[model samples]
Target: MKVLKPIYFLLALFLSFYPLCSRGEMSAGDYYIYADSVNTGGVISGGDYGVRGTFNESPIGFTTSTSYETRGGYQPMELGMKVSASSLSLGTLSATAIKTASADAIVWSDAGTGYTLSIGGVSGTSIANVSDGIITIGSEEYGLSVSGVDRAFTNDRAIAERLILASSSEPVTNSKTTLTFKASISDTSVGGSYSQAIVLTVSGNF
Candidate 1:
């Protein structure tokens, strides 16, 4: 098979999120009864703190507001994610053709609101990235695209500081996102077996 002009890359996946609302206590049988948001609604100074509460709602006589029960028992927000691979090898760079590579990330979250996934260059890069959101074969260009819901990188985009790849507004399970990296080079482009390092971070919105 004709290999796509591929670049070598090392990647790292980090899983962490800010619990914006409640603090999680030790897990009890079912409910998170501790550290889960201080249930006090008052203006300590000029800051107005909103009250957070969990309840069992009924659709019979109400609109059945569900956000209040985001964590299902109002438990602390939770999230998990995994990358399918840690490295990508795009055989050899070509001057007359484009090369592509891809990797998959599966994420699950119970943060009530949802989660965010982003990619950023860990350090300097030798191959310049395409900033115009397009790849041309006659120039040395590198960029990335993504396939999934709430994707910010749906089109070719340069790898910048914490570039968001995808996000969700509601809780999701087994949300799989595929990231495709594309590259091109001209006859005058530099030739070498170089590798770049990047990071994928997933954050939950609790």
Candidate 2:
């Protein structure tokens, strides 16, 4: 049987916003109002210490992390995602032999609190998501592995439910996540031309 498998990945993105403070405020005991002999401003940094900025008693959106860097000014909420190839093809299938293919997901986001990456199997035939498993040919297995931060496909998961594949807690510029798809077939497994369609949706966090 000349078994050929192709998986297509589609990209989608969006942005979100949080309620902004009506007015900014200053933290307690913080010298938010500095009047220097030569200059004066609402903020000042001295020695090796400084402030991260204080606004209304308002809170950070979604979550907070000291490990995450902060950016000043109004940066338009932005997100971009693309797959190296719209489709990944696994040549011919051989019994007891695993066929592997890979695609790269490049993402760029400037949204506060970073962004999320999710994937769902829009369509498939003769193959199933092996999510976190190694494809065993004779076993007729199919699955994938994602390499990058916040790897979420660590167990058998329903790809039809649009599961989060990976994420970043901080804005990323041209970040790359590699998705390696593995598949195998059995001599007894019914197969002809196999194919699957996947949609990868990227949305910015608050």
Candidate 3:
């Protein structure tokens, strides 16, 4: 029997907004008050210090058993975020699988034959199609659909599309979300080492 080693990479990107306010000095006047002196502070001054967001983990790992072809298992990836902005938007998540030795390799091309990625265990915001692996939150697939690929990992071929992992109209602080990846081998799958990279990004709207 051949041994199969599959690696998964997780990367998170965060975008925050910080605004500064100017202070004005008022003097005693008749009807309307006029400011004799005004002081403008530079950006990154006099604002919320803890208004940024972060992820709990980096380069999240996943390992499959030797008998993954017969029996599949779940790889759980937990991610956390905190934002002080009035609104938040989660960007699309993408994945690209490549053979360790070969740049062009195809695993499971047939539909519903390779692997399925899903999202669950969310806090602070609501998500749709939690386990379906289809488009739900933004406008595209919520998770990756592992199908057989004949080319290298490129932007058009590697993207999962509109993941929309999480969002909020109000401020969300220290919230957690989990991604569950289930892998399996098809009849055409070869025995070797395989790996893939997953990227996720978060942005805020003030």
Best-fitting candidate, measured by lDDT?
1
lDDT of 2: 0.65
Question: TM per model?
Answer: 0.63, 0.59, 0.26
Clashing pairs in 2: 130-142, 130-143
- Candidate 2 lDDT for residue 197: 84
In angstroms, give how far residue 67 of model 3 lies from its true place. 62
Model 2, stretches more than 4 Å misplaced?
A: 1-76, 154-158
Task: Give residue 164's error in model 2 in angstroms.
Answer: 1.4
Per-residue alpha-carbon lDDT of model 2 for 1-206, expressed as tens digits?
22322221111111112221222333345344333211222355555666443334222233437777444333445689889999888898778688878888889998868878888547767465564445665767777778866566654343564777888888888788888777777778776898888998888776
lDDT of 1 by residue, 65-156 (tens): 55553223344356898999898877788888889899998999988788889874566564888978788888898888899776765578
Flag regions of model 3 displaced more than 4 Å.
1-162
lDDT of each: 0.71, 0.65, 0.28
**Best prediction by TM-score:** 1
Backbone clash count, each prediction separately: 4, 2, 2
